[model samples]
Target: MSSVAARLAAWWHSGSRWPAVLLDAALIAVAGADLWFNRMPGNWWDDAVLVAGVLALAARRRFPLAVFIATLPMPLLMGQSAASLIALFTVACSTRNRWLLSACALVYAALTIAPWWGGSDILSESAWPVWGVYSLAPAGAAVLLGQLVQTKAELSRRLEEISEVREHEQALATQKVLAQERAHLAREMHDVVSHQVSLIAVRAGALQVSTEEAASKEAADTIRTLAARTLDELRYMVSVLRAGGGAGNGLAPQPTLDQLGELVDNAGMGAELEKGPLPELSPPVQRAIYRTVQEALTNARKHAPGAAVGVQLTQDDGAVLAEVVNTAPKRPAVPLPSAKHGLIGLKQRAELLGGAFEAGPTNTGGWRVALRVPLKSMS
Candidate 1:
């Protein structure tokens, strides 16, 4: 029973022409039979006029103005019809043509009153003023209704166009935001993997130069072990960076506050640590702190070798503050060897998690990086 009901509902909703055409044929047959039986004092042309005009209405959605034109000639040939008035309304509502609509209105007025005023039909006996009033009044009403429907359809079409434009604009904005996000994620991944590779290269080079047999063997074994670990770390970083779709590496443990000292030691930049009993922080905040320290130390070693770097972290009221400062190089300053993207990437990461970052040389003769992140961002 439910299946039958569903099928019936689907049939009713479907816009099939066969049903409407069959209905139009039935209506034409009944109207024809009625005209045949009631042989009024009208001309034989009335039968052809009535059926032909209304049957044209069945194709109104496809040729709306043509249906109105078909009906217009009938009114002139066989007098006024209520069905013809309805067809004029369909034309005005469906077709986007103003000149054709105005032409239709003028034709409707002329056709409605012409037979009564001059033709030798039964309507001619009716008083001229009364017959004109009766026929022209309905035609005028149909024209007014047509004008109103035209205005409504025009407004609806304009609204639909505006909605489509708004959707297109919103899609463009979303794509721009997505592109920026992907670029930022790419930079972050590059910074992390590059920092790790730099450490591996330096350590591996040191081990190759050592002379003591036992110590050299131990260092070589450590380098091999570190290389394997670095590969695993790279896979884990890629998985996190890709989120859902890329390499299916398993989840890795995130570095936290306890790992900060180890990260600075690994950089081999000879950093000096100073802290004032920091308060608890979110995991992402701890990671940011680690990344900032790691990058700053790497820059010092790369550009200002043998420079003493100072790393500091502290809690002041509600904010967690971090700073990494290094003595300026003995040589004159040169532009950092990068795509000018490190500071930009760092700023974006800081801002994304509701933090502030400042990186540049101080007037007092040293480079400094300072960051302040709010605890509430994690919450």
Candidate 2:
């Protein structure tokens, strides 16, 4: 009953005015028909009372209390009209004014019994009580139905609000979990990977000093330099994660466009660098570009040793582009242990700044990795 009443009230309160207008028109028609078919010889003023009462219902939703009060006198003048009952229902459904609703219901009951007190011949004196019951039944039903509708609408609104709050809280909880996981991973990498890399650097340094062959010394020196740089970068990542993604003292200054040449030279792979005027970029973007190049070079050394590699960096039309290409291996490639997250991480970094990344084999049987990042978005 409550749900049905709510649906009816929702339809009534919808923005369209035609439903109310049509309802008033229908009430007016019924009143006119009652006056015509059951014409009372005396009491000609009933016609005017009925018309006024029905027309007053048009503004019931906007001024429900006032309309209910105005329509109260109609039943005394015209016995009873649908307009008066509807006005009472509208008042009950549209407001939480229990005082007004109780007053309207009292007046409606009095009007229902007024005809008996006025000594009308419509019913026998003995049957007046039963006639009163019949007259009051519909009005009582309307008031109860309106109250049900009001209760249901309020409940639905509160439920919807609670649902929204619950969803918001769930999203916040998920985000917190992700942040904690990232911090934990960063700590593990720093404690484990950084320590191992530092040990590798120490070993390489010793090798560089002890080795007699010039080529072996050079190779050891290269390994020690790369390991030290990797440790610095790991420290920066750990600091960022620990700080929950803000600048921190432990975070080393990131590499920029100025470091590209040294980065390629230190890779120890025979790679050619192509240069063009580079756009000024944010620190994050410069870091992403450098990592892209570094990963490509590492992949070449691991999977395609002695391959001729080319690194290119250029800026054109408000975008910075980086590409690294390496030809097929000239010798058996060393099977290096790899986690294979390098390219995936680079792709994710580029997309975070609204850029694009691609890596695939070239038609010439060489591997190519390219990144195109928008400068405006990076800034």
Candidate 3:
């Protein structure tokens, strides 16, 4: 009942006044019909009071006490009590003061039985007791019915509040579960993955120090350099997971266009950079472009060994474009395990920013990965 009342109140506040309008019209009709029948002929004053009481029912919801009092004269003077009974019920629903309600009900009942009490035969009538008892029944029933509606409405409102609280708790619980999973993942990377990578870097350093062959020493140096960088990034990731997010983790800045130069120099495979002067781009766009090139270079190194990669960054017509093209492999490719998820991730990243990503073989049997996304850049 409370939920229904709340929704009705919301609907009313939302500019729907028809329901209340119709309800008042209905009440006036019912009370007016009763007046039509019980109205005394040639008693203009009595009929006028009844008409005023029925018309006043329209304001009962807002002014229940005043309307209930206004309706008392209709029952006492004209013996027309339908409008008064309706007013009594409105008071019961609106007013929470028990003492006041009891007083109002008693006054209505006394007035209703006043006609009988003042009738002919006076105290000599035995049926007076019965009439007085019957008068109390209607007033009592109206109050009881109103109280029932009020209780139902209260219970419904409490249930709706409980439902909202439960939903909020459920969401917090789900977030806790996700945090636990992230913590677990962070532990694994720190305990196992980071430990193994550290060992590789240590061994490479030892090999580089002891080796006499220039190529072997160079390879060891590159291995150690890459392994150390990986460990730094892995530690940053672990910190982020343990903290639930990176926002307050005192983390290093994310990779962006500024880092692309260092990326190409360390590609291990031959890579050339051809970047033009471009507008400052948003962080996400810069990250996307950088990653696209990084993934393309990794693919070239893995699948087309000895291939020369060309990375180009340019802005055309308010759009940033990043394209990585590799020449056909000059030697037989080394077989390696590959899932090709990197390209799919790049595609999804581009689309999320309302951009497009394309990757396929060029006419010269070389692979080409390209991204073109439009966005406003900060001045």
Please list the C-alpha lDDT of all candidates, in the order they appear: 0.67, 0.76, 0.81
Off by over 4 Å in 3: 1-15, 41-43, 120-125, 243-379
Q: lDDT per residue, candidate 3, 55-145, as tens digits?
A: 9999998999999988888777645388888999999997678898888888998887676565665466687677667778888888988
In candidate 2, which residue pairs get closer than 3 Å at backbone N, Cα or C atoms, i.e. clash? none
lDDT at residue 184 of model 3 (Cα atoms): 94
Error of 2 at 49 (Å): 4.1
Error of 1 at 111 (Å): 2.2
lDDT of 2 by residue, 26-102 (tens): 86677557545543445657666656666777677789878777777666665665667777888779877778776
Model 3 lDDT at residue 20? 76
What are the models' TM-scores?
A: 0.46, 0.51, 0.58
* Native-to-model Cα distance after best TM-score fit, residue 340 in candidate 1, in Å: 25
Model 1 clashing-pair count? 0
**Candidate 1's residue-wise lDDT over 217-243, tens digit each?**
677767867776776677676545543
